[model samples]
Every structure is written in structure tokens, then in C-alpha cells.
Target: MSATTPPNAPQGLQNSIISFPDPGILLVLINRPKQLNSLTVEASYELDSVFQWFDNEPSLRVAIVGGVGKAFCVGADLKQWMSNNKKGIPMDLPTNGFGGISFRHGKKPIIAAVNGAAYGGGCEMAINCDMIVASASASFCLPEVKRGVTPFGGALPRLMRIAGRQRATEMALTGRPVTAHEFKEWGACNVVVERGQDVVDRAVELAKLVAANSPDAVIITREGLKMGYESLGVGDSSRLFLEGWSKRIYEGRNMQEGLDAFTEKRAPLWMDSKL
Candidate 1:
């Protein structure tokens, strides 16, 4: 694998394209368009590895993450989850969570070039990026509630912090899709472009703008801001939520029902009667 490639990416991720479009900008495309770039365990790990590499490389100052199809990503691969469950294999969530960037703390800025729908963990991944440039057709949603799972990939806390508590609650609880324009207005997305392909161009333009600045200064500024945010207890709150609810949400009967319904092409019979 090249420096820009995932060190041990599985065959699925070996196909995840990576390219350097500028001197200090890395462009990463989630290549599984057929499945809406939904994340599998191996893909998550590979994504994490790629981000780690980008962070460590002094020459690579910024990264642009996008998907190669009509949808940016639709979240976890329910098919893969069902397969693992049928085989009695536990779901392997990467340390950095879905897409490897959700819970990751890195000084280097990553920009999401959302070309289409970003649902559930996909929405989480987009929000996790330092900035987002979304196409006009792009939409975002945390539909985990509909799937009988919580958005455990930092969506709960991060969305509330970025988009306000009321808006976040509406999104999480209603499981409704929010347009890119709406997200931009809500302060989640930074830019909204007219064309899908223009999303990448805008992201690259932003990356170039950042890359032209002093690298050390950018890193320090980012670190300082992150430190300030963490000092406000947001990080701790998110960690606590994750620890208390993640396992239950992911492993509960509700999740099973959700995946099964998804695979069976029917509506989920949610088992969480209390919720």
C-alpha cells in the first residue's frame, strides 16, 4: 500500500480510492457505490488507517472524504451485520467508530464533500469532519432511531453542539432527512454547491486555502480550539453517552429486528416498546 493507502485495507477497501489532487490535499472516495458506501468492519478500520496516515504525514495537511455514487453513505452495512449475526460473529466496530473519523481526535482538518444522502452513521461521519461542503442534492439524517439503534458515532453530542439541541433532537427523534441547504443553515455544513461534482472542487478549494497557511499554526489553532471545546465537558458527555448506551443499542433485539427487516425488505417491527 502507498503512504496514502490503508496499511491493511481488506479487499473491499483496497478498492476505496485515494488520490492526491493537490500538493497537500488528500482525496478519499468511499468506493462502494452499489451499497451506498455503507461501512463494513474492514472498511471502517481501513478508513481509520487512512486518516491516521494523513494525520501523521506532515506533507498532507488536509483530507477530503466523499462517496463515489448518488449517495454519500447510508451508514452500517446491514447485510454485513446480518451475515455476521447469522454466523454468530460479533460486529467489530473500529476504535475510531464508523468511517474512522467519527470519534477520532486529530489535529489535521478533514473536509466532507457530501455528494448525496448521508444517513445514520454516514451523517455522523460527515459531521465529524472539521468542515463540510455538500452538494445541493445532498441530504443528511440520523435514521438510527428508525432502525431501533442510537446514533452512537458521536452524533448525539456532536450534532447538538454543532446544530443546537432542539434541531438535533428533532433530527434524531424524527428520523427525517435534512437537506444540505438546511444543514448549512443549521451551521452543520459549511458550503452548499449546485452540482455533485462541484462539491469536491469546493472542498479542494477550501483545502488549498488552508494548505496555503502555515501548517504549524493551523495544527496549533485546531488543537487549541479542540482543547477549549473539551474543557467545556462536551467530550466527557459524549464519552459517557457512548459508554452507557452503545453496547445496548447495537446489540439489543431492536438492532436485530432492524437489520432483519432491512434485509427482508420490510418495515422494522421495533421491539423497544418503552421507547
Candidate 2:
């Protein structure tokens, strides 16, 4: 790699593997399959660093995260949580939340590849991703309540927004596993990879499409979308977007290249996102 080119993956990543499956696209695999991809606090923090690096790396415009085994993530390590509680430790999540994604507000977009069962924090991570592609056999649930806890990993409110109050309440209260198709109906899962297909491959395909676009637009447009998704009113969101990223985007060279390419009827040659 050139001095200007960042390493393929961030250093100090022991719990996850990062691969560049396409230009400007990153694929993250949670390495723990034996524990059903359960995360301890340390693992969560380590993944947090990985994503933090992803955000700062100019070349990586999109990310697809999945597990290595039959589960995306089963949430925190319960045994570790119990032990920490007994030892007077908080057993809390990093600011980025479970697997460094549930509460992430990053500059770029991430897609969740739900290859298998996603429970507790795992489900929350998938819930908050910019998009999700789940295999037909994938399952989802928030089972914390059954273990004398609540789904406190930022899934509750986001679920209400995506799936609505009634549906969210039904899933939260019941703590029962649901199929990928059911989640699709709830508007939580974007696409269900049919049987005999790979969820991560589908996610990577989606990521490559996004990566092929003007990287600056992808990031700023994603910010605008989030402002619309999370903010109260469309008018206010538009104003905020115009005041913020809209100005930064116009100042960037990619915007001009995109306009020029369109005018010339040629494909845009976009640079890595600098916005």
C-alpha cells in the first residue's frame, strides 16, 4: 500500500475481520461463531475502533457487516455480564452501542447481512443499520426481557420508527423469534435473500452499487436521509441539510465532476469522499 493508502483493515482488530470486497466497499465479519457471535465488552469496544477507523478512511464509502457462523450476533456475553455485575462493573456498551453499530451515527452507510439468527444486541445492530439483507432462514428477536433486562441497546425507539409502535411492542413484549419475511413486513429488513443465496454477497452487491456513485453525494445524501428519518419535520430537515452538507458538497470537486459527467453523457469518475 502507498503511504497515502490506509491499511486494508484497522490495527488491533481481534474480534473481527475487515476485507475490501470492492473498491470503496468494506466487509466486516464478526469472528466469534462458537459463542454464536456473542460479544463481550472488550470485543464491542474493539469493533468500535474498527468502525471509527472506517469512518475516517477516505477510500471506504460503504460497509457490510455479518457474522462468521450461524448467527450474526446473540448480543453481549451473558456470562461476562453476570460476572461483571457481581464484580461491580457496569457491563455497559460503548458509546457506539452493540457491536459498535446499534447507535452509530457515522458519515458513511453500513448494511447488515443477517445470515442466521440475530438476537438481543445482534438484532439491535441489524435494526439500526442503514439497510439490512437477511437470508430466508435468518431469525430475529429481542430476548433481554426474558433474562430480567430490557432491550436497552437503542433498538426500542428506532424500532418504533421503522416498524411502528404496535409492531415494535409486539416483538419487544413477546420476546419471540420471528422470520426474515416477518421482519421485511415490519419494514425492518430491507431484502430477504432467498434460500440458496448468500446474505453477505447480496449486501456486498448493494454496497458496490452505492460505492459506484459519487462518494461525496453518498455520504451527504445519507446524512440528509438520516436527518429526515430522525428529525421531526421535513422542512426543518431540508433546511439543516441545505445549511450543512449541501454547502460542503458544492465545495467538493466530486460535485462538479458529477455534473460535468452528466452534461457530457459520460460516467462520472468520482474520487474517494473528502466530505
Model 2 error, position 135 (Å)? 0.5
**Model 1 lDDT per residue over 1-275, tens place:** 12343343233445378888886688999989999999888888889888887787656677899999888989988998889989999877778888898888886889999999999889999988989999999999998878777888888888888888999999999999999999999999999998625789899999988775545446655664575455447677566545654554565565677678889998654431121
Using all chains and alpha carbons, the TM-scores for the candidates as numbered come to 0.79, 0.96
Question: Which ten residues in a row are the worst by lDDT in model 1?
Answer: 1-10
What is the C-alpha lDDT profile of model 2 across 146-242, one tens digit per residue?
9889998889999999899999998999999989999999888899999999889899889888988998899899988999888558999999889
- Candidate 2 error regions (>4 Å): 1-5
Superposing every Cα of model 1 onto the true structure, what RMSD results?
Answer: 17.2
Per-model C-alpha lDDT, please? 0.80, 0.89
C-alpha lDDT of residue 138 in model 2: 95
- In model 1, residue pairs whose N, Cα or C atoms come closer than 3 Å (at least 3 residues apart or on different chains), thus clashing, are none
